[model samples]
Structure formats: structure tokens, C-alpha cells
Target: MNRETLVEIKNLSVDFSTAKGALHVLRDVSLSIPRNRVVGLVGESGSGKSTLALALLGLLPDNTGEVSGRIELDGENLLDVPPEELRRLRGGRIAMIFQDPMTSLNPVFSIGTQLVDAQRNRHPQLGRRELLKRADEMLKRVGISNPEARLAAYPHQLSGGMRQRVMIAMALLCEPDILIADEPTTALDVTIEAQIVRLLDDLRADFSGSIVLVSHSLGLISELCDEVAVMYAGKVVESAPTKILFGNPRHPYTLALLACEIDPEDEPGEALVTIKGGLPDLIDVPKGCIFAARCPSRFGKCVEEPPLCEVEAGHKSACWLA
Candidate 1:
């Protein structure tokens, strides 16, 4: 079976109205998600990871000033699709598992009800009983025991891990072609985080869809993603296969990000590695390489912005040095 591009993003850019100026959230970003592959988006808090995700789902905030780009799903540009078609595609062809399950799940409804509602978009012909059965099986698949009773419980009734599991079950219930998990393990304990990671790993193997893991955890990205895209400020500085990116990153930003990863087996009392400078101001982004200000290897040629270009087969980087 050919693993062709399932979703293709080209020159995607987004800006928001801010008191200072137009805050460029995403800047000429382009990426490809191959079928059944796991792609990771790694960046800092303000790197616009979530914004990009929301943009893909056509869920950008009302404050968004401008959005220009082509987000193609199986060759169809979703950005140009009608509102009704886009709405149907949001949870039907594409679905998302937000960072905080507690906030993503409704406190007022039982898990069963929410799960059934989630399926209605994709399986409108299925009856309530059938949806409930499917939801029950999905909950069990996500490692939630006693699915029947758990379905009847509200989001507040479950533990943090359980709530996250419920969120996963709900997203899966949609039978989407693409699943976007935005910091799915955020705020969970070490044990629960590990569980969620393992669960995702298991699902990626069996699920017939591609996944986008939006996370700050390099460790997680290195372990789970087939490909990795590194973002800085509001642009993708580097992206490549997981091994290629981690083994031999081309951009300074990617190198700096790898250097900041915590090594569990390191010598004791070592100060935690940290990136030097903070993110650049998106309102007035630097003209040259976004990472040049803090890049230790900066040179005179970096004064002008570098376009993301292929430096090697199947690898691309946006740095003059690359």
C-alpha cells in the first residue's frame, strides 16, 4: 500500500489583531502528513502550534485578522470548502484531542452521551443504541475498564487519566481520517502520561488514520513521531524524518531544541539545559533567520531571511547555514 500524502499544508499563514500590531501566528508554513504516519509539531508556548492546529480544523478565533493558505485534504482545499461541508469535515474527516481533557469534555453530560453525540456526525445513520455500543467498545479499547458504567459517569467523575482516556475515546468515535492530539498528556502525572503515550503508540499501529502530535516534549516526539517539524517564533525552521531530524538536524533552532531535552541518565546535580533567548516578537519579527539572535553559529549572511529549502533528500531546513 502506498503511503501518500493524506493532508498537505502549503504556505499557511495566520495573523491576529493585537494591541501592539498584527501578531503573526503562523508564517508561510507548509507540511505534509502521510497516510498512517505520525507527525510531530514541537515548539515553545507561543510558537503557534495550537493556532496551526485550530487553523487546520477551521476553528481559528474570531480575532484572527488574516488566514491565507491551502490546507488540502486528499487533494481538496479545505480552506475553500463551504461552511456546511467544513463543519461536517471538522469532526467527520478530521478530529482533535485537545490538551486539557478536563476542559475539553463537558461536565454537564455523561461520557456515553457525549460519545454518542460525537458519532452522530460521522455515523448519522447509526441508532443511539448502536452508537452507545460502539462508544463502549472504544472506551475499552482506550484502556478504560468497565466501559458500561464509565459511560454513564460524568467527566468530573473520572480521574485525570480517565478523563483523558474519555477524550481519546470520543475523538476515535468519530472515525476520522486524521487525528490531531494537542499536548494530550499535559497536566497528567508521570504514570498517567506514560500510559497515554503508550496508548497513543498502540493506536497509531492499528488505527487507519494519520496523527498529528502537537507537543513540547521532545522526548515524546522522538519516541512517537515518524516525522518531526520544529517551529520557532511563527515559522517552521526544520522538518524531517524522526531519525534524520534527531540524528542530524539542519537548523540551529532544531539543534538548540534537541540540546534542551532532559536526559534521565545524566550525571546527578547537572543544571538543566536551557535555550538562550526567548521567542522573537511575532508582531515585528526579525528580517533574517528567526533563530539568529540566539543562534551560536550565526554569521553575516543570516541578516536576510532564508526560505525553507531542501538541503538533502527528504529533509528541509529554513536557515542560511543549512
Candidate 2:
């Protein structure tokens, strides 16, 4: 079957009116995620990854400044949709597994209540017993043992990994068309993190939809995503098929990121490479390249912001070199 474009984000820009001034979070960022594929958004903290996810779901803060751009899901413009429509679409057409599952879950509510309530938004006709059964099955699918007993427990009662798994189960119970996992494994250990990633991969067979995995771990992205968009500051500096991008990173920012990845062959006590300089202040962003201050290959033209242009077929980079 031919996969079609499921989500298209075009020229998206976001700014917030803080007490000090306007803080630009996203700048003309555009991306396309094909149906049934996993697209990874890899970037450092405060790179606008989570901001983009909220924008896609029409959940941006109302106090924010003008947000310009079109977020189209299955050819429908999400930005122009009504609030009620968007709310209805959120857990049904779209769902998010947040960075901190503990915070995402309500401490007052039992896990069963939260899971059942989530599904009830779409399946209000479901009986109490049926809802419990569905929640139990989903919990099992996410690798949680004693699903029935766990459902009766509160958020604090479970281990960090268990809570994260419950969050995953809740998000997937609705079977959304788009799943935005923003640092889903941030709180898990190495073993649990691997298990969570594997669970997500396995659940894809049951969910015929696209996923946007927002993470700072390039290794995780490389392993789970079909395509990757490398974000810097607030812009996408490089985007391409995962293999192609890793094999031939054309952008300076992307190359620097790749250089920081751990290598198994590296000798003991070798210091890992680090990207020079800090992220630019959003309130006083430069007119030039976002990475120009730290770019080793900086040139005269880099003093001007470069458009994200195609460097090769199906590969694009936002650099003067591209």
C-alpha cells in the first residue's frame, strides 16, 4: 500500500509574550510525516521540539504572540479548527506521551479511572466492566504485570517505569492517528528505556498511524525513526531519511551533533566531544545562521540566515553550504 502524507507543517513560527519581551520559540519550521512511519525530532533542550508538538495539536498557550503557519493533518487545517473540534481531536486523532508521566497523571485519580476516562471520550457507551478490561489489556501490552491490581492504584503507588508504561498505555488506548512522544523515556533506566522503545515499535502494528518522536537521544532516533529532522535553536537545520542523514550529514549543526555521539570503539577515559557555545537567546536572535557563532566552517555568507534548501534528492539542509 502507498503511504500518503499524514501531517504537513509549513513555515511554522511561534513566539510568546513573556514579562520581559517576545520569546521566539519556532522559526519557519516545516516538516512532513508520512502515514504509518515514525518521524523523529532530535534536538537539545529548549530547541522548540515540545513547542512544535503543542502547535501540531493546537494546544499552544493562548497568551502567546501570533503563531503563523499551517498545520495540516490529513489535509485538514488544524490551526483554523474550532476549540471544541480540536479538543475532540486531541485524544482521538492525536495523543501525546509527555516527558514526565508522573506529572501527566493525576495523583488523586486511580490509574483505572484515568485510562477509562480517556477512552470514554470516544467510547462513551462502554460499560464499566468493559472499560476495565480494555485498560487491563493495554496495561499488559505495555509490559505491566498484574494489570487489574495496578489499575486500582494511584500514580505514586507505581514505580517510575510503571507510571511511564501506564502513560503509554493511556495514550495508545485511544489509538490516535498521530502520537507525539516527547522524551517518553526521559525518566526510565537504560533497560526500561529499551523496553519502552520496543513496546512502541511493537504497538505500531496495531496502530496504523504516524508518530512524531521528540527526543535528544540521536541513537534512539536512529534506531526507531524512518526519517529524522535535526532541530537547532528554533529551526530545522537538516532533515532526511535516517540512514541518509547519518551517512551524509551536510549541515554543520548536524555534523557537530553526530560527532558527539558515543562510539563503542572509543578508548577508555576519552572525553566525549561537546558542541561549543550555548544556545542563542531567543529574545535577541541573530540575523545570521543560528549555529554561526560556533560553526567551525563559518564563512561570509553565513552571516545571513540561509533558507532550508534541498542539498540532494529527499535530503535538505539549512546552511549556506547546502
Candidate 3:
């Protein structure tokens, strides 16, 4: 099948002016999201996964961060659009389910009110009765029972899982072209996390759009993503189809991440292997390969940075070894 390209990011970079200096959060990053596919951004903390996701949505703080790059949606570059056009695009063609639903949701407003407000931008003509009906249906679709009662409850009244579901429903109510879920299952229990993941998996068929799932959990990415991009030190070190990435990872950073995945069958005394050394300083990122400091396979050639090179069909890795 010839899948459509829903979003394209080219030479994207973001830097923040900190007390110390300019802290680079993203560097020359580029990727694409195909229509109706779930792509995951996987990396440890400080890897700029969430930063890239926010950049896609134009959510970065204007004054604090300097962003340069083309965020192309459909055929037009979003950076070139006016603020009003970007605002219209946000809640209409694109929507985001923030990591913390509690913070994202207005504590004073009832769930129904929030849901109605979510659609207000796109459906101003919708009557209250019609909006309420749509909200109830979306709630039920996300596996929330007693949808009518839940709508009357405030954000504080709902459990973490329920709040997350409500947030998902809100993001999807308008049927956006792109859904950016930043750590959708964070802070939930194991059972609830599994449930949320399954719900998102089921949503693919119902919502005809692409999904960018930003997470650090390789297990969740492997289970839910059709493609994965591995980020490190503000750069994408590797990207490929999910199965290929797991079976034949190219970048040393990608392999290190796999090494850290916990196995249920491990002996009681077995210690989880951790990636040696901490993340590089973003304010002063290495001039050469960022992972060279921790990479066991690093060679003298790694002293110079490597551009993303295609190692095989549909698989690319940024490493001298590749």
C-alpha cells in the first residue's frame, strides 16, 4: 500500500536560552509520519523526545526557545503559516493529549464542559444537546462506563486512568489528522497502562489519522508502534520499522536501550544492565558522536560526527560503524 505522508519535519532544531547559555534540545532532526500509522519516539530522559513532539504541534514556548525548521503538514509548512492559522490547525487538524491530564484539564470545569469546549473551535454551530451527545459517545468509545455521570464530574473527581481516557476522547473528538500522545500511560498502574495501550491500539481503526507516541518504554513502543525513532542527545540516531529495529538495531545507542529492557524470566539475582555514563550536556553537546563517551564499540573515526546513513532498505542509523 502507498501510505500518504501526513507530516514531514526537515532539519528541525530547537534551543533554549538558559541561565548557563543556549541549551540545545533538538539538532538537525528529520522524520515523517505516514497516514494511519503509529510512530514512536523512544529515548531516555533528556533525549529530546517530548521536545520534538511539541515542535511538531508548534507548542514550544516562543520567547524562551528558538526554533528553526520546517514542520510540514500535508503540503504546506506550518512555520510559514500565520498565528491564527496555526491556532486553527491545533485543535482542528491536529490535537495533543498531554502527559499530565490533571494539569491539562481545568480543575474547575466539569468533564462535559471541557469536552464541549474542545469541539467549540471547530463546531461552533453545534447545539448543547448535540455536543453533549457527542461527548457521551466519545466517553463510551474510550471504555468509560456511565458516560453521562462521568461528564458531570470534574477533573479531580476522576481517577488517573479515567482522566487519561477523558483526555484521549477530547483530543479525538474532532477527528484530527495527527494525534501527539506524550507519555499517555505515565503514572498509571500496570493494568491501567495495558488497558490504555489497548485502547489506543483500537483507536487506530476508528480515527483515520497518524499517531506520534512519545515514550521511553521500549516494550510499549514495540507493542504499539509500526515504526520507531531512537533519539539521543537531541538527535535521532536510528529509525526503522518496529520489527526491524528490534531484530537488527544498528546504532550503538539503540542497542544500549535494548540492553536495558527488563526480562520477566531473569534470575532473582540478575541485575539489569544499564547504559554506562549519563546523557551528554545539552548546553555543550559533543562536537563529534554524542554516544562515543559511552559506546563500547566506539572507534577513532567516531571523533567526527556521522550523518544518518541508510544501512538497509527503510532503516537508517547515525553511526560511523553503520
Candidate 4:
């Protein structure tokens, strides 16, 4: 692992055994996120975006799933850590904000109780009064209008946007070194989503920690991420600085994703370009490129899986043509 890297995933693979067979969810996925940087993981639904996030946090469901790889955090291999140590590291050194805030939050407990619990978990020595004070302050920082009033409310009492803000506050209270937001804004309205994005930007600026943003929106990735990784069926197809990936995408899958989004200046009647063919079933993955069936530029070489090769400085693409 690089000394300067905050989180490094090397040759990571994850699988789940079902009644049918073994489902390969992540295939040789590797990524490096440096300190104080934002790396966006973008792909369509069922592209293993959320799986990768959960794997990093060691939060996969037990009994059916298996994970293997080197997941190093701040030079320590988290994959090899003991269960007790991993538990301690989860909320103290790294935290995760799940996609559905309502589901992540407790419907029965008061928001204050949840936030205070999180605070106490991190700083157990802090008194109850101190924990409450800190929780209120964090709530305010996350843009809640009346921190005291909202703290008394249950998760169901608050709106979706407000619940998400509370979730962010809870995550921030831990002062984690790396924050993983898995589709954090997927359930909010446009106005609230923009506010959440801005709040994340402000938090990142002040916290000085690495962030892993997993989302399906290309526009959001372009606006908020410094670096981008494009995922296909179960592997990263391309990765580069935000500008480079958006300006000159080398993988057909990446190009298809970008094309699916409508351009502001496009003609009124212009039809969106949709990628033909659906993602391959994980239980029976094809031998060649996962995207070769839908790739417009695929050739005979595409029948054999292509390695992720460097296409340019700091840019890599997994495509035979690239």
C-alpha cells in the first residue's frame, strides 16, 4: 500500500452463495483513495456499486457472502484485522452513510438518542450533557433548522431530506478518517439533494479526510467528485481524474453511460442513446468482456477479457480497443 493513501483496495473479490449457485459480485476490483480527496464510484444499478462500499466497511451479510482481498486503511490491512478490532475501527476510523436514511435510522428511537449514542460510542468518557451538546451542534452544522426540536422527533416525524441531514450529522460526530456515502442523495428531492451535496463539500473541506461517493448519477459525479471510476457488471472499466474521464472516455460502457444523460444544449426532440442488452447475470458471467454484448466497437479480441491497461497518465481503461 502507498504510504500516502488513506484507503487502498487490491484485487478485491466478493461472492455470495445462493440456492442457485455462487454469484460473483466484485471481480478483481482495486482502487486507491488518497487523503482529503473525493473518489466517485459510478455505475448503473446492479453494477456492484453498493456491494463494493459494504465490502470496504466489512458490513456484508453473514452466512452467504465471502470476501477476499487486501483492504488497507492508513497502511493497516483491514481485511486481516480481528473481528473485535474491526468493530472498533468501523465507527471510529471509518464511517458509512447508507442510501436510505430512514432505513439506516431507528424508527422508534428519538433522533437525539441515536446521535448521542453514536457520540458516546466514539468518546465513551464524555458525559451525557457533553454528548447532547455535541449532538445538537452537529445537527445545526448539518443544516437542521431547529436542532433541539428535531432531536426530540422520531425518524418518521422528519422529512426524507431532514432524515438524511440527521444521518450525516451522526456520521460526522464520529470524526472518521474516511467517509463512505453510498447513494446518499438517491431518496431526496432536487433542491434538498443540492443542499446535501453542498453540505458534503463543506464537510469534506473542513474534515480533511478521504471520501468514497458511490452513486449512479453522472451529473452528480461530475459536479462533486475529483476522481471517477466507472464500473461495469462487476469490475471497474475505466478510471481517471474527473475531467479526463468526462472529456475523453475510452471504454464503451463509460461512453454509453455519459450518452444516456441528456445534454443541456441538445435539440428538443433528440432521443437519448440507450445501451442495448442488460448486465450479465452474476451467477453465469460471460467469459469475455462483461460489456462486449452491448459494445458498439467490440471485435474478436473482446471475446477474451481485457486487462485494465494504462491509456494515459493517471488514466486506465479495460477495453481491447482502448
Clashing pairs for predicted structure model 1, backbone only: none
C-alpha lDDT of residue 55 in model 3: 79
- Please report, in order, the local distance difference test score of every candidate based on alpha carbons: 0.88, 0.88, 0.88, 0.86
Q: What is the TM-score (0 to 1) of candidate 1?
A: 0.95
Clashing pairs in 3: none
TM-score of decoy 4: 0.93
RMSD of each: 2.4, 2.6, 2.5, 3.0
How big is the RMSD of model 1? 2.4
Greater-TM-score candidate between 1 and 2: 1
126-201, model 2: which lDDT tens digit per residue? 9878988999999998999999899999999998889999999998888888999999987787788888889888
Candidate 4 Cα deviation (angstroms), residue 238: 0.5
List candidate 1 segments past 4 Å from native: 265-273
Worst-scoring 10-residue span by lDDT in model 1:
264-273
lDDT of 4 by residue, 1-322 (tens): 3326788899998888888888998999988888878899998878898888888887776744777888988778887888887788776888889879988898889998999888765899998789989999999899898899998999999999999999999988998888899999977877888899999888877986778999878877888888999998889999998999999999998898888876745421122235677789899888988888888998999889999989998899999999
TM-score to native of every candidate shown? 0.95, 0.94, 0.95, 0.93
Q: Candidates ranked by TM-score, best first?
A: 1, 3, 2, 4
Overall local distance difference test of candidate 2? 0.88
Model 4 poorest 10 in a row by lDDT: 264-273
